[model samples]
Target: MLDIVKQWAWYDWVMLFIRLISCFSITATTIQMEDYLTLPLWVVVFWEIIVFSVPWICLMLSYRYYLIAEMLLFGGLSLYLTSMFPEAYLTLLTPAFLIAANSAEKSYRWSAPITIVFLPLLIVLFSREIDVFEIFPQIGLAYVLGFAFHLLIVNHRQNEIIRKQNSVLEQYLTQIERVTLLEERDRLSKDLHDTMGHSYVSIIMGLETLRPDVASQEGTEKLDSLLQLARKGMKEVRGYLHQMGSPQDTLPLVHSLRQLGEEFQTHAKVNVRFRAIGEEYPVGKQVKMTLFRCLQESLTNAVRHGQATDIVVSLYFEPQQTRLEVQDNGHGMENWKDGFGITTMKERAAHLQGRVSVYSERGEGTIITCFVPRLVESADEIIRLFIVDDHSFIRESLRTILEGQRDLRVVGMAEDGAQAVELCEELEPDLVLMDLEMPNMDGIAATKRIKEKWPGIRVLVLSTFQDTEKAKEIMRSGADGYLLKSIESRELAETIRLVHRGGTMIAQDLLHKMLDAQSANEQEELLDAPNISEKDENSYGLTKREREILQMLSQGMRYKTIASKLYLSDGTVRNYASALYDKLGVRNRDEALQKGKKEGLL
Candidate 1:
């Protein structure tokens, strides 16, 4: 009862006021008409008070107690009052229909039959005072109409709740986003500080090491090296800015890969080639980003440690998958070792439900290949849609529009959350357009249950409310998308199609709000996650020599150099490296290197 009052909005208050006024008007008319039973005036007043005040007080009680009070008052006292004075009919609308609607909304399956049974008794008792046939239809019509009005008011109040919640969420998201951006900028500034400090220290040390031989070739060469270090430090600052300023979408995928190859070629002073096989196909944004990062990391490893003079990056497209391979004509090791880079590549590939493999030999080049699955459109398959909303008009509108498309079909519909679950379980529709507010259950709870039972069934929230918190809650509940009722028909269709193809769709305005909220949350989680300790080789499932080999490789040491340092034959070193690769679950040096850095092994 308290929760209901707390959730109440302006529409509820207005309805309450209107109901009170109408009840008062009917009582006044009864008093003016001087219509009374043979009972005394005080007795009449007692019954009238019981009829009006009891139901009002009942609202404050729990549902079970309230129903008991309502039944005793309305089924007994209300019926008697109406039987004696039919004029009570006008006043009964407020409390009687209100209770009935409340029961229908709160306990639809449990209370409905009882209410239906008692309703006829009330009408039959009223027949003694008035023409039963003449008034029955009128009273029934009024009850139905009142129930409809209650549903509308309830929906309006729900929208009010959503608006209030969204307001709070939007403010929080904006503030968090601001804080996150400031922190990121601070981190970048700190990195720049460290770089500049190191460069300045190097310059100072070179100056201090110089003697009166400042005019000598060695002194001149030292000054030149200092100048070069300063220039390189400045270039590092520019690189950070370029990365921060340019969004990934600004560069086409192929163009970006080519540019990545070209930049590495310029820096590493190696011949690098980029190639694409088969037609360029559509891939998800996350998949594209992963591939790009993998390529960048691979090139860095090839030139930095592979001793490669020539490199090749290739992208191959198939009907249902995209494959990327990076090959380097470098003096490869006798056996492949897993490093931080290689582990990182594998992790990135796994994000797209993909896998990575590596091929290398003692002197021959190394090739790293990653395969990622892509969603493919099939001409023969039809996209099934399920509509779940309390409003018939909304459901009908969606069903009509969706059914008109040849590739899309409305497989089922439900009026509320409980029905939606049952229908979805039986029909197993591909997509569900669910409304947030309903009679028995709500969209959030239903979405969670549906996803848990049938994870393949994608749920898209179709709500009149655009609450950011509610949107996040629904997404957390495993909904694929969220949309507002104000969406145009064409945009709605496109969004459905996108979601059906394993893409997420959020209303543009809500999308921006959610992005702000999610960005802050993601950054916070990223910062909060535990980092791998460099010395904890056992914790990371690595042997001592494996850790040592990884550290040396990170320093750009070759296999022979590492073997000499460790006082082991090159072949023995290779065996230990291969064992590390298996332990790390990585195929190549680049992935291993990436994984090592991620796990703090380097």
Candidate 2:
């Protein structure tokens, strides 16, 4: 009841009043004059109800701007009816015209007063027995007062309806604002997971990968300091998980650079140092963090590609902006291919509305600098994660594990191979745990296909199939590994470590497969699947994507089903099949299938 009233609009009240008045007056009119079938109440009732009800209904519909037609219609109807009804039935016109004209309460004020003054003249004209001036004026004045009072009450009711509508609008606006905030939080969290969260993880990983003894004593202290910073980052992530908003602070840029210098010195055989050139002040936390990431990414590049003996870190701060530089003395940039670390560094710099520079000489060194603009960083980011598995328990379990990792969060869950593939592609998980034998794209097939497209990705096939055939098939298909799905919690960590180690894991089973193969070599290996050449594509005059479609069509997947698999529209899929059929000199799915099979296109 409250919800309905809350949704009711200003016009609804006037319409309701008009309806009530109309209902009463019409019923009274029916009693007064026995004209039921001939009377034109349909137009009046429909107009009144719609004019009142539609406005309220519009209020209920979000994103619907106000429509002006209802008002114009009601006003036009009132004017027409007023002109015609005055001559035919004055009593009915009095109420009907008043209710219809009641659309504009403001107009009633002026029109009602004028009509009051003119009423005496009207009565004199209409009545024969009534006195021309004295009695008519008295009756007109009484009618005017009563009509004005009714109009005033109706106008007041309109205002109350408006007030109530405003109250509801306020609540709705608040809900919308909250939803917006949550959505914003979700967006920021995704940014962090892919950006800042990954940043910190790399920082910690770099720090841990470093050996303390490999660096100088001073460098050791600096590396220790970096570890402490990582711990501080963990705390911040924890505070967010606890829903506690904290004052975000940036560690000194010098501290982060020094830490990186020592870490690089230990991790790689590089002599690295931090040097400050200009005057420094407390730059904003966001700026400092951006600078830190800049240094970390630069160092990662240097270690990964440049076999350097020394690297220099410099900072120059001014009123408008700050400059961060990491120069490496390494094999240099001439032959250095594109790396993720460099891309991330450049991307992060751009995200900060800043510019990054990379200058390198073949023999001298690679120099990287970033200029950061001023932007206040959001303190809280809500992470969203999605996990896919055949079991709900596995999804929940993975969620628990991921959530346990500081700064790692999960947003959604999915069950089964198909859903897993869907969510993996949709969420683009940092890691995908593939389970072997489930409906819709078996683990082996999904892993191979996903890796073929995205090679740098990490996928660990968690399967109960301990068979060497499974292992051989999986790895050959470019899967990261085939692990016993029921790996103990203790063993899981090591397996993950192997996975993220940037290579496939060769367990005892895999080793046995390798050794057995070495002992009894088979020429036609189970691992090697026949690859279709461009010669085959040209022979068939169909692309691999087209061939795959033709094969599915041969297997009898409807256009809709094909569209779902290929992530294309049904029309697009039909067009592809149509083209394929045309190419094969055949019409329809079956002929295409038979031709495809004959040509080995399938």
Candidate 3:
């Protein structure tokens, strides 16, 4: 009975209590004064018992049966009780009926409203027979209580449902996290085996060649080979570190193409050559990745579908645009309707604002060419910049150098982070060249505040020190780029222009030093903290692509440039940036970068 009551809604319980009270009140009235109702005492007792049981029966039954039963039982009882005993408290049954029907139905769509209207009409009809004040107020209060209880029960059930759904969602999310961790573990193990295994083998082979007492040419050659192997091993390890942190730090287009070529040669057993046709030029990361994907997808099709034995990937770096051609000596298809791979290839090309052309015939080899237009800031695109540094000479020097350019303007200057943030709000400049160390507030805090207010504002960090920790800190803070104080004026101007155009430029020397220092510290930490896994060390909950964007933004690249480089739309990039900021618990880029570095995400 208690379990059944527990299943009942609040209104059901209240209606049960009301029926019980009505039954007792009527019984007491009948016993104290048999003349009160002008009906037989036996009939009154039976009616009161019947009325008392109606709400309980209604609550226990299913919706369809409960509705029919409640109406018949309450309607018959109300007509009889009111007709026989006009002054009886049988009038209370009206509110109870309304509550029970609605509660049992799991909705108050019509029952409660109709009951309200019926009650007033009933009071009007029985105005002289019924005590106007007593019956009206009792019915009114009963209706109010019933409706309120019904509302409470509905809200309670909704809350319970929501809680249950939330629990299920949480469990799903937990499972997803576990899956992600497992995948990450698999990836890390593969990277470690591929990168470190080769280095260790080379080192071991070189060590085997060493002879303590030998002074022959063979021994000298062996020693030199050992030294070379050691150097190569160090380079490989550095490359691995870059992969863990920022791919753009070292994984350029040429490197990626070569890596892809090697992979094809190893797996497909095909002779592949990745050739560069022009002088090397800095292309956007988006263009590079797109070209890489184009090569990858085309090469895959050639090997799997086309059964190609040899392939040539040509990368053409033109003055205005970049072009990639994947030519394979494979079996050409007769009817070449775009399938999933071809469609995806076209989509990737289109995403870069590039066009893809597939030329294939039955006997002749297939050639896939993709041409992506490079985004270069035109002469008319002048970028407004603000400089914030404590040293008057540095600020003046930067302003003089930048303002001299036709496409650059120094809109404001500040000596501290506070001033920088305040001036940024007022000026709303396109870019801000900030110094990490300053009075009133530091660049880190200022960048965070400024970015929180104006997310679009790009911040470039200029510092004298090459401290990896500071660089990581500033990068984490959301600075788009970092530069050393020792930078040449011309180089500084070019870097500013590059960053303004949505390209990233970390002073190469600073990056190398930071990487080296970081690698060493990581080695030491690895030895000291052997239990720390890759995910545990750097799980700020960001994807590889997001970290890439964050790395670029830390180097002071703008959204448009990042989008172009990433081969994403401005809106997509903005959404990613916004999501990144949220995950890092920041409102702007600076804080995100700062938080990322602190959390080891950088």
Ranking of all predicted structures according to TM-score, beginning with the best and ending with the worst: 1, 3, 2
For each candidate in the order shown, give its overall lDDT on alpha carbons.
Answer: 0.68, 0.55, 0.66
Assess candidate 3 and give its TM-score to the true structure.
0.33
* 2 versus 3: better lDDT goes to: 3
Best by lDDT: 1
Write one digit per residue (lDDT tens) for candidate 2, span 305-417.
56555678888876556888888877786644335556455444443345566777787779888886432222353234445466555566667775664444575665655
- Cα lDDT over the full model 2: 0.55
**Cα-based TM-score, every candidate:** 0.37, 0.28, 0.33
* Model 2 ranges off by over 4 Å: 1-135, 212-225, 240-559, 562-602
User: Least accurate stretch of 10 residues (summed lDDT) in model 1?
Assistant: 167-176
Count of residue pairs whose backbone atoms collide, per candidate: 18, 5, 16
Off by over 4 Å in 3: 1-320, 324-375, 485-602
Quote model 2's TM-score.
Answer: 0.28
For model 1, what is the alpha-carbon lDDT of residue 196? Answer: 60
lDDT of residue 587 for candidate 1: 80
What C-alpha lDDT, on a 0 to 100 scale, does residue 228 get in candidate 1? 73
> Tens-digit lDDT track for model 3 on 1-602?
66557557565666566667766776786667777556788887886676557555655655555555555555455555565467544454554445533554444555554455564456446534776666656666666776666667778877865654454345434534643454454345345644474356556555655656568988879777877777787678656644554343246677777776776566555679888888777665445656766777777777666767689999888887788899988789775645556655654554444567778897688999988766554687888899999877668878987787777889999999888877887898988998988989998899878766875777778876656777777666666678766554555666666566544446544665665776687667556865444763454445455677888998899987886575343544665675466446577887887786776665
Worst 10 residues of 2 by lDDT: 62-71
